[model samples]
Target: MEQLCDCDYEYDSEDQYTMPEFHQKYKDKLPLLVVVSGGFNGKTVYDEVSTNQVIWFHRVCQQSRVLGRLSNQAVRQYEEFVSIPVHSGHMFNVITSSRNESDPETLEDILTKHKLPVLVRLASEAYDYTLRTVKRYTILLLKTYTETFLQGNCLQDDILLPPPLLLAVSPDISVAIATGYVNKSKDTFHRKLRQISEFVKRNVELKEKEGCKEITLFDKQDSTTGTGNSIPPDLLPSYDEDFMYQDIEPDINWIPPIPPNPGFRPSLPARPPDGLLCQNDTPVDSEMESEKLSHKQSSDVSAGTFNSLTVYDDDESGYNSSAGSVKSYISDMSVEDIQSLLGALNLTKYKKDFRKHLIDGAMLEGLEETILREDFKFKHVEVIRLMKYIREGHMPKQ
Candidate 1:
């Protein structure tokens, strides 16, 4: 009775179909496939294009986005597929052949594993393999950036990702990676985003090039090394060597400096008085003056200075300075300090996530075991240890 969005037909809120009817209607047809005018080859028989080929082509299209423009264009030209402007449910139906089940294993366990043909089984394997490969690349990219940029390692040059291949990395992951080259903060968020956009655009341009060499991420050679693999000399002109230059001898002639005009009058400073009364030279009634001055000083101290000092001391001196002094608190620590704390605690694996979340000194001060376990997904023992460190004031100080 539940409504499902089918890509083939106009969306109707009231329209609903049972599992058997939906499967029978769309089992042979590809998901998100629209029969465009001249989209399919004339000689190609529709029946010959099996569901297995459809699924294979679907995944090829998806993965080809990051592979290169030629591959994507080749797949699109040879296959009739519509990826954009389609319902996710419709696509899921094609791959899984299930009206309700969401997991890919459902196709293997209940659908393809029993009733599906050999080709369908092969298609499922291909889909899983390609998906896994893409995921592996994404993880590798994250790890590389984290190790080089986040873990206090020097990243001397700008990060250069292979064209289109970097497209496999999501924007959020890209932003996190950008943190290596850029500081993560409210002010730099848009700058990072703009930088990521430019990278994508450049990658796209490279992807479109007919002869763009496919360079794996992190495999790029260091240009500073001046190795044989470095960019060709013709690409960059030798400005230093080609620029015209000539040395000229210095002139030895000397000229006399100009003298001030005799008619010009210079301002003179005012003279001091002949005599002045010095404090030490004057005599006073010391005994009486000292007593009056002492009385006035005591009154002023009691009236204002003493009270103000008392208020300031009371406000800040509530805590034992030796026990939990402001200097020993973690609230003023930096990201590097947090990393040092993590190293001291032996929780280095969480450094990337900590940086990505901007978990600074102040956040650590208020971190709860529940937050570490649930939000950060830390293990129980790790959470316990961290909480213990926090409670005992064992965290690294600024």
Candidate 2:
């Protein structure tokens, strides 16, 4: 009614029936045993279907079963008996004739009587099981094959694989296998990476063995105490050997190095002899001329010379006598002498231009009278001493 099936059907003429014709005539009958052969000989049979024809047959029977046209028992029988190939490697043959064959029957008569629909259905079911088994087994086999391939080739100098086998590999499955191989390789790489520090240390040790002495960057041991030597006696405690080894007691008399006292002044030297105008002439005299002059003034005043008050300007010797004028004394003084004079009078603000500023400041302070007495002699001697001290680069006593 549907213009027959369009599928190009092949059958042995002696069998007297095509698969489609058999299915159409006896669609509702008990399953009949069918012989299956070819390509499935001596080799181990994989569960998967080996051809497209098998796939097509499996789909047809599966549809028929779902539509309630095929019995569950019939499908089960087909799966158990027909799906699996026999162990024998020969042409599989089945006889559908009854034991008593007294009645004559043609090939078509035998096929129709036995019901070809049942044979077709059985064959289709077998193919379905084969296809499913092939798919599942293929995946498992592929995983094992890929793992072995990676193990052999991942780190090899020249990687090699059978081109046909590689071509047969599923792209997704292959990628998964390759990723696992890479991960395993990474673990190996990490282990190798950790050895880098050990390698460096080994090289350094080797260099030392070869007599390449390393330079010490810093020495922890004190240089002064090394070389079998002890610390200096000055640094040691001042105690007898027995006392030193025993539990020690603090010394009440032990004193720390004393710092100089800021308020203490050193006593100055005695005055230089008469005619010794320059301080350099009495280089070794520790006493300042100011102190000597003060002493002289005290003695003179005690002898009643304090009231005379007049200072004499001795022009020839450039010395200001006890009776000298202040102006003549100032005129006879050098720049260094003037600076010293200013310093002694506590008028250091005039030090830059001491001669003029000193005269101004002295007049402002009305120091002429003071200069005529003890103060004048002291200042005069101080100027001479300070000039000498500066020239010799000596720090004068305060």
Candidate 3:
């Protein structure tokens, strides 16, 4: 914990049964900076400070799939520090599940729960690889870089580093660099980050000039502030990336055709079904509605809200409404429903048009490839998968 946070923190361990009392004591001072670990028989709490500490703490809890609770304010604050934009409602649910029991202590405890020395060996190997690529530098310079760029707390320890700060260009190494070491310069960290970023830029350009394709974070043409270079073709389909587009085609026996609708008709429901509120079936014709309902109910199991974790009932197919149930079969799927589907499929590029045009499953079932390509501006791959999703009512086999 000290290594990850780079600060001195007070620790407390209490039985799970006594957590209610502990929480009551701290309830008045809502949003205390602490790491609550739901270990078996007891809970381990760390008095943490700073955004990164909270993130790493939550990350550990998340990795272990333990239950954690954060005040609404803490959740919002953590979102501000995340490099990628997070959905305000679903952030809490993703990082912590409902299982508030049996957590492992220490990153190494969970990281190498079964294997011996895996975490240590992995970190050592990462350091060794950095050493190999950075062989031209002297030991002292390497040490300074390690402490400053790799371990510096200037940036958030995100799953992916944004743009020019993509040190090592490997998510595992980037995370290891973020959480594995510590540097405790509070005020001048940003300035140090700037200097290191500049140094990286110069080194990368020099390597490119020397015809060395060993390591590079950003392209020479794009501005440093702009998006970084496209990932190398060699690393194009990462393990997760490989699976992202998989299972999006229907099974062989479930094949169905989606004929083209003449003029793309918006799929906005004429009115909500009896008992359902307007908010429950809000149209996504505008940006405000799109932002509000697009990914609010993203998960398959539950719909997340600001104050509470609400699971969908057996009868309710989608989000909760004041009426107690939401009708969301594919035939009656709303704009928000399709938008959420796009989000789950990681097809964010089509989110705008899909929502703006009120494209629901009914509309999707009739969308033609030419129309999708020309009018909606969807790629060939996207059109294929989307049609399959509409026809099969689920992600299909690749």
Candidate 4:
């Protein structure tokens, strides 16, 4: 008898009289009965304890399943057990009945049981190599799942449903659940669900109106330009010569004028003898003849003795004239004008020093020699025009 009731019994002391011995000893004596008032209180206390235990059990089962400690079959059995409206006294029997010796249920079976069509579609559509066929199947499954489990009355009051289901139902609900808003208020959940349902309906109607039988999940063709399945023209950059090559125009306004070639000089026109001009109004033959004779004599002497000297003087004068012209041009220019001219000519290496030197009254001859030695090949007129623009404080258009 002790063994039979020992599972539910507790004792205050280990050395107390055994139950059987006590019963035999007291059998001959009159039995004592203690009356208890309010028997309903005991029942109420038991009910409260049992309800708490059941709630705890449900929570444990859910946690175990979510943590993957429980197999799908076990999850299903646990779900069934919790769904049964039984007192704590019968929980052991429910648990024993739900146990099975079969293999654990697979992931696919579990997903299917939960109405997870998106995952199912992903698994099924994976075998097909063709993008179009896979996309069509994917869209079809998504639309079907959205229409079915996501619509109405599928979720339980106490059970926290999966996120995908909530997402399919409404993004707002999913967000709310993530943020603990759904746990705080049931009205928010219901409101979000209604919004989701109405939104899904309107979406369906719009798709139907647009003649969209199935939306594409993966498009091989470019959609932006309605072009065939290749990269759009604007997106594809060109490596052709015309696109890569750019013509850089010389800045004529800021470039300095090219000086005249030193080796070439135009001959000067000859002037009549001074006496010849004065004698043109008189008709004295001897005097005029004597003047002509003297002029001839002077010309003969110059041609014979001083022709080389004359040529040397002419060359010197020509060089001096050119140097003077360039010097005058430089003197008239401001530092900014010189800097701009140098920059536009792409000769900016020594521009700062050169500008300083020019502003300090350095000879233009030295600058001209340096420019020539630097391999600048611009024409004289071009340099002049560029300097003019620089002086006017305007950059020439390329």
lDDT of 1 by residue, 1-398 (tens): 22132122122334322222323344344222111111111111211111111110011111111111111111112211111111111121222221223434322243334332111111122244333332221110000000000001111123333422211111111110121112345455446435645654444342121211122211122321011112222322132442211122212242211222212222322322443212223333466765665576478555544312332232344443232433235556655566666766668788755754335465576667776776677999888776655544544344
TM-score of each: 0.22, 0.13, 0.19, 0.18
Please list the residue runs of candidate 1 whose C-alpha ends up more than 4 Å from where it truly belongs after superposition: 1-314, 318-328, 388-392, 395-398
**Model 2, runs deviating above 4 Å:** 1-89, 100-158, 161-398
- Cα lDDT of model 2 by residue, 177-292, tens digit: 01112224656534433443344334322111111011111111331111111122332212233211223232334322222222222243355565342233433333477577
Highest TM-score against the true fold, candidate: 1
On TM-score, who's better, 1 or 4? 1
Q: Model 3 Cα RMSD, Å?
A: 27.3
Colliding pairs, model 1: none
Lowest lDDT block of 10, candidate 2: 139-148
Give stretches of model 4 more than 4 Å off.
1-278, 283-325, 328-332, 348-398
Candidate 4 lDDT tens digits, 1-398: 11211111222222222222322333244121111111111111111111011010000000001001111111111211001011111111001111212233333344344441112122222233332333232111111111101111112333323221100111111110111121346566455545545544453221111111111122223221111111123332132322312333324575555543333444532435554422333433477676776686568556642222243333455554334545544555544555665677555654533432222222232334324343344456555544444333334568
Q: In every candidate, how many clashes are there?
A: 0, 11, 3, 5
